[model samples]
Target: MPATSTNTCRNNAVTKVLELEGLTKSYGAVQALRGVSLHANEGEVLAICGDNGAGKSTLIKVISGAHAQTSGTLRLNGREVRWSSPHDALVHGVATIYQDLALAPQLSVWQNVFVGAEIRKTLFPGFSILDKKRMRAGAAEYLARLNQNIDDVERPVADFSGGQRQAIAIARALLWNASIVIMDEPTAALGVKETAKVLALIRHLKDTGVTVLLISHNMDDVVQVADRVVILKAGRVAAQGALEGISPATLAQTVMTGEWPQVQ
Candidate 1:
């Protein structure tokens, strides 16, 4: 998904890489989203925390261009954009990793990394084939940059551990020069160690200057990586602010009740 929406951070430090204003989506008479807004800043991690049916998936779908907005502005770097398709969002450097991660179990790591956008070496005047050598080398370079220790880029994705597979998916996004990465329930079913590894990768992305919008119900992961928390309740923003400004207890309260505390 492309980083299509931006909301101002209550904290006063950075500029938003993406913004959404009055974003709405509907399915016939049923409204999935209504006038919701949020933002992800450059190099910052923004977490969207909400329970099931809180409109999180709809929000990501709209932003990713999997679903068109019924009304509102999708802004990247403050300019309103009307994304017509998911590829349009991808062309704008927004890459989304759904819970599925979109990896091919039967394909080699390098092949999956360059699946649609494979590099070609024109050996003759008009012929081109997949450049296995270039692809392998480039895949190794990217994996190494992520500090991953995969010994064989030729091996299938199913051979890699969960963490390594997640790393490969992330590296694929980076290979495409994605500036904003949206990850939905990235750590959903992983064991403790795998979840830790994915969390570390999230931190690594933040340190490497990529803005991240993480969607998860895990409060622990939310506080650990997110600089700010945007709680989407009943298709609207119920509470949003710097993480430091809100406590875990308060966040949990908001999740259960859909109301921000007074903090008096």
Candidate 2:
């Protein structure tokens, strides 16, 4: 088990976009989360780090509405909110981009971006058609927001690189006007170039005033993009603090030992 440290980070004067208080989840015989509490301030990148079985996935599942917590309160923008499903959470301005990107390989760029929430135009009183023109244009705009230039919006997603696929997933979040974006292992497997591109996309999201909850195992990646970090250990918050003076080596050490003596 890793050592525990106090939670000493502050949000300054920024607003808390998402707050989880005493959040817990349990199975018939196992408790996955034990009173986990954390907050993500508006327009900031908050990194979540932990070893395997540290409850990172469960925490993301609860926040992304894939599963409901056994007991806890979730506040979005200072108001209590509960999600019935992932789409429910998405429509309420929270979107999660998983490690796989959740993109259809056969679908085109615009189609993938507008997968669940496709735009349509009513041609008659009772009939509507897919609005490809508007959707394509909108998708292009979203991609542009991430500094990506995909000349063909009709290109298949499978043809793009790993980082480009991430951009497509993020564009979908932008289409929904998500106030908070949760990215899970955004840079898990990629070359140096692709990882850098993904990092740039995260910075772009923060620049656009979008709160990002980044869950990653790569300490260097986390250290580069995270404004603050929360380290979990065995279904509990072992430690959390700002990453201002923490190096990648220091952060990795803290994750392994759950101690941040000098970084604090």
TM-score of each: 0.92, 0.93
> Residue 45 deviation, candidate 2, in Å?
0.5
Error of 1 at 251 (Å): 2.0
User: Compared with the true structure, what per-residue lDDT tens digits does model 2 show for residues 1-264?
Assistant: 100111122445788999999999997778999999999998899999999989998999999999999999999999998899999998888999988888999999999988887879999999999999988988888888789999899999999999999999998888777888999998898899999999999988887778999999999999999999999988899889999878898888888888765623
lDDT per residue for candidate 1 within 44-106, as digits (tens), equals 999998888889999999888788999998999888888788778777778888888889999
In model 2, what is the error at residue 20, expressed in angstroms?
Answer: 0.5
The list of candidate 1 runs beyond 4 A from truth reads 1-13, 245-247, 262-264
- The stretch of ten residues in a row with the least summed lDDT in candidate 1 is 1-10
Q: What CA RMSD would you report for each candidate?
A: 4.2, 7.0
Instruction: Indicate the residue-level lDDT of 51 in model 2.
Output: 95
Candidate 2 worst ten-residue window by lDDT: 1-10
